[model samples]
Target: MAIAAKHNLELKQYDVTNAFVHASLDREVYMRMPKGYQKPGTILRIKKALYGLRISPLLWQKDLTATLTQLGFQIVPHEPCCMIKDGIIIFYYVDDIILAYGKDQSKKAQEAMDQLKQRYSITGGDDLQWFLGIEVIRDRSKQLIHLSQVAYYEKINRLVDDQTIRHDTPMATSELMPREGLATPSEINRYQRKIGSLLYAAVNTRPDIAFATSRLARFLANPSQEHQQAADRVLLYLSDTKWLTLRLGGGTAMQVASDASFADNTLDRKSSQGY
Candidate 1:
């Protein structure tokens, strides 16, 4: 959406400080005393949403949707996560929201955002930087929008001290055959941990790792030595291509093409080379 604007639109972001807390609870519930509260005989009477509760997210979303609707924003039928007003489009993922609109609607949206922020525990204005771990980079000149997770890679590298690892293609052309032996309990645990981290990286911003991550994740409990090596290859790939990012140019729409060969899975044994 930003790409299609071509610098004529401005992008703004805002965060709901305690989004769940803003949600009105419909059920009567009680909570233990908060740490600082001196209510020795009192408990928190449920009035608003709180994390870990089953109904928290739903309540927050309901309230948030209502608030946005009241502000003259029309919820897009095709996308409940999106709202539109005049030329402005707003997309929300829980508490984090992105507003995109031309110059005229920008100020009005900003005003509404300011009013909302004041009424609720929300953060707004131009200084908002990161949202949901996704780093936002705006090309004001070309009006291009790019989201990446290079910071996340750095964090993982620092944690594992794998910054110097080499990068390789995520997948191998070779096929695998399952073995009859069971995996050691400790080995299985370790494999699951490593694969979990890799999966997080792949889903966040590293599309290049998607294939490799998915392929290796299937053998988490009883992975062969070959699978372990393939997992390492993914780390190496990240190390070498640490700067690679998904770049979005000025385009009116997104077009994706995919080709799949039936029986692509090795279990089915049909020769397939697809992207």
Candidate 2:
């Protein structure tokens, strides 16, 4: 997504129909006949990959790699899911594909799409608005692109009790200590679920809550009441800032900063560092 913004590229999305079934199986496999197809005692041999098969993804990936390579796109060394040809880039997550190209390469992009359509059954050619649950907002005039998870945040907010108060920050500066008693089984389960949801957001676009979430994760095995409250605070924070997005582009140069604190962890006497 950052690359698309940096290059001022037009983004498009495509979905390959029955993508897994397109890959032919390399090994001979058989399955029992269905109830409706029962005839004597004969079984059916699988000719193509199926959804339940563990090796289906590998087969699909291999097929996609071969097809892209034949189309003059080379798989990126560091990112196997990415393919590049000239200045245009193609990124695929399972069956969904996102295409990015500069203004001058619109024809090339269209041609690539055409080639893909001829090679496989696909439905696309529209400007990208959403992908993998992330809402993509592009402002070509401002040369900016923003990624948000408003719906995802709201969905998880429903899981939280209505009494949770909103907060400006995901966590407090005050130190958190283990409570005197262990949490009940139900309480522990609920805390784990909430933490898991928050962790997903942190790893995706909510870097602001990453540190707090990571710190709270330490007590997952036996979270205390205080820990549960801290976790709830993170959800309340998400509700308060559901519209917050990660913006790319609109900057001339990159800037980075780092910090460190000696012996910041009270329990382990370990130093903390961040960039």
40-105: candidate 1 lDDT, tens digit per residue: 787778888889899999998888778878878888888888888776677889888887766767
Q: Which pairs of residues collide in model 1? A: 166-236, 167-236, 167-237
| Candidate 2 local lDDT, 1-275, one digit each (tens) | 88788768999999999999999999999999988989897999999999999999999999998999999999889999999999889999999999999989999988988998888899987999999898999988878899899999988886575445567888888778776777788988988999999988998889999989988988888888778778888988987898899898887698988877788788788887886
- TM-score for all models, in order of appearance: 0.82, 0.91
Best by lDDT: 2
Residue 252's lDDT within candidate 2 is 67
Count clashing residue pairs per candidate. Answer: 3, 0
